[model samples]
Target: MRQALRQLAGRVWWYPHDEDPDNIQGGVAVISDPAGSVVVDAGNSPSTARRIQAAIEAAGLPAARRLIYTHHHWDHVWGACAWPEVEIIGHRAGARILEVEAQRSWSHHYLRAEVEANPRLGPSFRGRAWAMPSWEGFTVVPPHTEFDDDLTLPGGVEVRHVGGQHAEDSTVVAVPDAGVLLLGDCFYSPPLHLRQAGDGYAADLVDRLMSEYPEGRYDWFVDSHSPPRSRQSLRDLIVSG
Candidate 1:
């Protein structure tokens, strides 16, 4: 956990779901520049939302301006209920996750209480669940603002919708001047543990984003898991792919 925190600069932060280790991961980022800072993804609990809010405040950014839903997974969007004022953003494919998969994942967990009771769901995340993001009883809101491709995104910073990787709505939010590109789970490091997301991941999305990220041009690369990578390494992953 400390290593993950160290990976992100002071400007970004995250909150973990104290459940089975592999259960859910919460990530949120802040970019307090011109276009304005934005929260990349909401976590599982209101405390997580509050932590993200605290991180944003610590970074000296606004309380609420933009909220980005990398994907509509339960852990990613469930906590947004904590901040109803923020404008949510995501790709159309992600919108479907809200409308469809969000509940499915929850039902899978809720209905599988026996599976969870049997053995903590797995050896890795095995433990008494503390605060897993439960959509079991909450409102699921669709992305208020949806873009297909190449959007004039906001975050107190200007970002371009680079290309698709995670899902059809997957977009690489790039702050050109900062050279900081938020690769929304495009390259899931083993550290960013999860089963899978609709048959996407590994080198597929990572390779695509790297190919389009101006090639050996970015100054910083941020993902939910792998911390930040220098331009050389960022391009190398793509080049190697």
Candidate 2:
């Protein structure tokens, strides 16, 4: 998937999921600096981490000094264990989710629910369909650094505090000066995980982003499940502009 959709927005690049019928996006943002390169948001799976690393290599950046998880969710943080050398960073709120949610969240939601729902999850899930993995081996670590409102990241990127509407710990990395928003599951085209438990908060988050940010002027809008529904939802807001 990273091979198929490696679209770059200045210092940041996106890798999308082509194999997924759901068309979710799991990407790494590469922002280069003299110090080194920083990759944002580790992908959902180990395979995804490999692809993202390959893409980063293809982009011609040296080994990344750090990786940042946009938010702490199974699809986002699970793969961090795949990349050990890179120092991970996130907001305090996100850091807690990584630590507190308990691997139980991962077991109940991802390993159990999704795969049992479909075999496309992988053929390895054949007879052990009901079998689930334990998060016992998993180690959840908090972000080394936490920020309150807005923080300027390398490459002139602004990591903004998008507090309301989305998950209680949602974070939005906005290149406001550049008109790009690296939203982490805030808004997507067909609506990423729309049917999940946080539908009401998710809906509010959608309204906030659409009403707050500018329209197509932004060069790119990136998200974990960055879907077309995001475009349409924001387009309505643009009309009011």
Candidate 3:
């Protein structure tokens, strides 16, 4: 699918998630600043990352200076190789996870073997392993800078670690000046592959998000897999879900 770069608010632009493709991917956000753009998530593969880069360039946005990872999932971080010049950043725990993932072989055969041996290696893994155009030079680049709680980048972009059921290293990025908050899967329930029988939302994390960034605090709530939502809409979905 030809995904266009859509502006979320002021200087924030995002490439929406694509579920139509065999290799489903998550949304990627870009916070444009004079210093350089701050990108959220590298992408699912080199091709995906390049597409993101192309979109940014096409929009006349600044080149990416820093890549912020919401977590160390393949769909979110494996595309780092495409942006070799950008400084990568993420949660310390997420950095540790990527460090371990970096050592694993990404060869098609190896990935297939892994999925067969462990079902938890789920559809996400299977799709990336078999559907992406090429894994010939696949690489995993962990964050160069790590933070435990939260960090603010140049131009008032805030990244906060909000550990949850989706991924323990999950985080949400806020461009307060623009009234935009990018919730990188932090609000989602654990994927079926990783879920226990009664696994549900991480109550503490949900409470934190609700209270810390309540309605009116951010005009747009951008989730990795969904379209941007109104602050109240997200709150309602979270509460009802």
The candidate that achieves the highest TM-score relative to the unseen native structure? 3
In candidate 2, what are the lDDT values of residues 182-226, reduced to their tens digit?
777654322233344434334556557656776775645666654
Clashing pairs in 3: none
In model 3, the Cα lDDT at residue 207 comes to: 62
Prediction-by-prediction clash tally? 9, 7, 0
Answer with 1 or 2, whichever has the higher TM-score: 1
Report the CA-based lDDT of candidate 3 relative to the real structure.
0.84
lDDT minimum window of 10 residues, candidate 1: 1-10
Using lDDT as the measure, which candidate wins?
3
Give candidate 3 regions above 4 Å deviation: none
Q: How close is candidate 1 to the true structure, as a TM-score?
A: 0.68
Error (Å) of candidate 2 at residue 152 is 1.7
Q: Estimate the TM-score for candidate 3.
A: 0.94
Give the clash count for model 2. 7
TM-score of 2: 0.67
Candidate 2 Cα misplacement greater than 4 A, ranges: 1-5, 18-25, 101-138, 176-178, 188-217, 227-233, 236-241
